[model samples]
Target: MKKIIISVLLLGLIGGASAYYYAFVYMKNRKFDMVNAEAASVDASVLVKAYQENETSANASYLDKVLLISGTVSATDQTQMGERTLTLSSEDPFSGVMVTLDSAEAAAVNVNDQVKVKGFCKGYLSDVVVTNAIIVK
Candidate 1:
């Protein structure tokens, strides 16, 4: 009886310590910086089409991955968080590629400008949202 009780308590302690290490130490240390990360280079139209055709597959492939996309700038806005948000035109008029960048980067972009941008694909709502973006061209 005493041996069984001690063994159970030991297993519980081990499990708790493992959970704490994973949640605090292991996860906290892993970081991917979108600014300098390697990304898949694609056209804005193609990106939008993939989502339109099959959103589930598109999200699996693109979500949380860095993408370098080239397209015409449709609109730009400065968010309250001081980040610049841009809408890049897709071949389809309704769905556009939304890119988020630093205010300084957004300042240089104007509406209808042909540009290349790199950012992390953050899944699609109505638009394909990209965050932590930077102007590459």
Candidate 2:
């Protein structure tokens, strides 16, 4: 009957609104934890080990913080953006940080030496930075 149709429509609107309300609430509460987790120290060997272990805390620990990671350097073409900034990276299809190096030191870093860097977690798709990397060896 007409009465039955009207009731169903009303119930659908209420249910949809309720779903949206809960989703909003959940996001608000989870944001703090997701963004404030401590940055974990990362090493390639340790990362491999953590990935193998069951329920490792590595990912959560570094969720949204800066981390210093050490790895081999890959040389990139030196470029500049405007006069003040360096054009280090073009756009990426995936998520990660786009980084620029201090122009004076960019040349010393070749494609083979081991280097260390500090960067923050912008998000999963964002990149980690290597703030002020120097050639250690």
Candidate 3:
């Protein structure tokens, strides 16, 4: 009886893993986005609002790849060693949305350069991000 119970439990575990994998990773991978480095520049405000409605919507405009955005370096995270992260927020005449970067990318920007960054639309992160981010740029 104990051996039979263990077999049933093992079967259940395997089935659950298979279902979860297909539902999350497999489906999401079909439309997963990558960044592009070459494209015409766009006004930053137009982006923040579009994402407010849908993340995948901009995939058509930006080639489903990375995008180049222009904004200001509003905040940053200092590092004792290596790179420190910087937060870039929209400088568009209409909004104040924020985006994050790894320490190294963040370091290349400043508080008020009106900088242009090339990264992807990674979705929303609540207070940290209204609807846009350049995760790898």
Supply every candidate's count of residue pairs whose N, Cα or C atoms clash at under 3 angstroms: 0, 6, 6
Tens-digit lDDT track for model 1 on 14-88?
Answer: 999999999999899966565678889989999999999999999989999989999999998867897888899
Question: What is every candidate's alpha-carbon RMSD to the true fold?
Answer: 4.4, 11.9, 8.4
Q: List residue ranges in candidate 1 displaced over 4 A.
A: 1-32, 103-107
lDDT scores in order: 0.89, 0.42, 0.53
Please report how far candidate 2 places residue 83 from its true position, in Å. Answer: 11
How well is each residue in 1-137 modelled by candidate 2, as lDDT tens digits? Answer: 99999999999999998888788876667533212334455653343334234323645655345555555444444435421111122123232222344333433555544554444433222333333222223
Model 3 TM-score is: 0.44
Model 3 regions lying over 4 Å from their true place: 1-36, 59-64, 78-83, 91-108, 127-137
Model 3 lDDT per residue over 16-125, tens place: 99999999988878642324445455545656656655756654655334556665666655545644444555534334445444433433555765666555554544
Q: Name the 10 consecutive residues with the lowest summed lDDT in model 1.
A: 101-110
Ranking according to TM-score, highest score first: 1, 3, 2
